[model samples]
Target: MTTRTQTLSQAGAQSGILPIIGAAVLGAFLLYAAGFAEASVLHDTAHDARHSIAFPCH
Candidate 1:
């Protein structure tokens, strides 16, 4: 008993939820890899003199 517009709207709304879910999952994986629950060795290494924030280490 739905019109064409309503049917399309429902489809669009359902499809929209997936990208949000995917983004949340990706963020969680990144945080986990960053050692949120373990040792963040990569992050620690990035803080060394070899990895300066400003350009031109010289």
Candidate 2:
């Protein structure tokens, strides 16, 4: 019973974690493809953006 509970908890943590991690990887790829590395200055490319694309943020 204890093992089953631990397994479920672990699965729940992984399910939530994987999406966050996958999104981070996708975002990083997009930023690099967009040429953030060569950018002299980062500004708002899109209006009302929740976060900047070039820099990591919540």
Candidate 3:
């Protein structure tokens, strides 16, 4: 039988893992879209975003 502390520790570990996994998935999707999506779509959107922050896209 698992003690209460053991159970709570396991739950805490799982809760921490879930957000890391979620962020990894989100990052992967963004990378895929940036690389594979049509330029007309990603380019204009990213370009304007960079300029808005005074980033030199040139």
Candidate 4:
């Protein structure tokens, strides 16, 4: 007989995979879009993010 903790853990593990897959798909889509996007557009979108992370953008 499985304990409640074991049951909850199993359920959580199964459900956790969906979010991981979704994030991976989203990341891939964003990467693909960025690849085909214009340089100016990319620069504009990431300009603030680069500055926040202390990355040189200029």
In order, candidate lDDTs are 0.59, 0.58, 0.70, 0.72
Model 1 vs. true fold: TM: 0.38
What residue runs in model 4 are displaced by over 4 Å at the alpha carbon?
1-6, 15-18, 27-38
By TM-score, is 2 or 3 better?
3
- lDDT for model 2 comes to 0.58
- Per-residue CA lDDT of model 1 for 1-58, tens digit only, reads 5698899988878787778889999999865554343344645643343234432222
Clashing pairs in 3: none
3 in model 1: Cα distance from truth in Å?
22
Candidates in order, TM-scores: namely 0.38, 0.36, 0.39, 0.38
Off by over 4 Å in 1: 1-15, 37-58
Residues 1-58, model 3: lDDT tens digits: 5798899988887676778889999998885555445567675767666557654455
Better of 3 and 4 by lDDT: 4
The candidate with the higher TM-score, 2 or 4, is 4
Best by lDDT: 4
Ranked by TM-score, top first: 3, 4, 1, 2
Model 3 TM-score, all chains together: 0.39
Model 3's alpha-carbon lDDT is 0.70
Using TM-score as the measure, the top candidate is 3
